[model samples]
Target: MSKPALAVLLTRHPRKPPNILQTLLEVQASLGFVPADALPEIARSLDVTEADVAGVLSYYPDLRTARTGRHLIRVCLGESCMANHGAKVLDRLRAHLKIEVGETTRDGRVTLERTYCVGTCPVGPSLVVDGDVIGRVRPDQIPALLEEYQ
Candidate 1:
């Protein structure tokens, strides 16, 4: 099935103009992260200045301005996970995928990200693939886990 058009699903007009940050947040939540071109679209739709839209988007660390992959792979970098070799896990994945932590593959298969916490402390060195949590990740196991999706 085709995924829902993120922009239309996210925007909720409350009979008043959406605040600068609110509009962007809605877009981010639905679209995964805001695209660079989305700033102009948001400004035109909300009747807000382009600068205002850009400012709000830049201020939020959770928002990304780049194109992303189909599946978002978020690895916890929390203290527990970090101590358990989370960095090595991320590095191995990056090498196997041939992409940086924040980048997607050429075919747009996956995007790698380092998140602070996924609230799975007991499962340290955890990895979340498209919102499905897998705990106790070992560096060597990343390739086999990713092979399933291929």
Candidate 2:
């Protein structure tokens, strides 16, 4: 997360600290993932029980509670996407990037993840970077797309 986002999170719920989920989400979105040291501060700033925050963080995979790369790659695993060859595309991407699903590149350039859906079914087998949606992605195209980031 960015430094300014921390300020935003703090200000967003000044008198009233956010709930555990919101606090986690805020920190995660801002920092890409929650830092271990941040738990205490987040708990304090949000006025929530630390255990509650930890429990929620432990439960949700969507809520990344650790460091990740700067760029995020979300591949669709929904039925439509799968039918449209999403898995092959994902495999190709992983091979090209030399990183497995749910892992980040060594240089911190990209993080790969799987999503049940992105709701762009009309153009199934979608890939999202940051938040930009790309539909009809071909397996062979993965490397070229990633090259742009490098």
Candidate 3:
């Protein structure tokens, strides 16, 4: 995150009570990923150790330390989706992207991730590309769907 942005986020919550989690979330929302440079500042503001800040970040899966790709592809692994061959879809995506779950492609075009559910069980085999939820996804559809993002 840029210094100005970080400053704005910090000043936005100048309350007497400290809310480290909210501050961290604000930073995450502003910057797609939490910049390492902001940790010491956050720790100082919250009157805690840098390690404490890091521990909180590590506890939340939504918080990211590194930059993400242009597009995020999350495959749903819920029971219904899994039974509907979501695993096959994930496998095909990994093969096509040449990257495994929780990894981004070399070009930084896309990041593949796994989620428990997307609430599209009726359709099942769902995948979310960017922010669009795609249901009833198939292994064969991976290439064409990926093309849209690239």
Clashes of each: 0, 2, 0
TM-score-best of 1 and 3:
3
Residue 1 in candidate 1 has what lDDT?
A: 9
Maximum-lDDT candidate: 3
Compose the digit string of candidate 2's lDDT tens values, residues 15-93.
Answer: 5435677767777766678777667767777777778778898899888766768888999999999999899999998
Better of 1 and 2 by TM-score: 2
Q: lDDT tens string, model 1, 1-150?
A: 013354454355643656877776777766667877666767867787889888888897678876578788998999999988899999998899999877889999998889998899888899999889999899999989998765
TM-score to true structure, per model: 0.80, 0.85, 0.92
| 48: Cα error in model 3, Å | 2.8
Task: Residues 36-63, candidate 3: write the lDDT tens digits.
Answer: 8889988887788999899888898778
| Runs off by more than 4 Å, candidate 2 | 1-8, 15-18
Looking at model 2, the pairs that clash are 1-30, 1-31
Index of the highest-TM-score prediction? 3
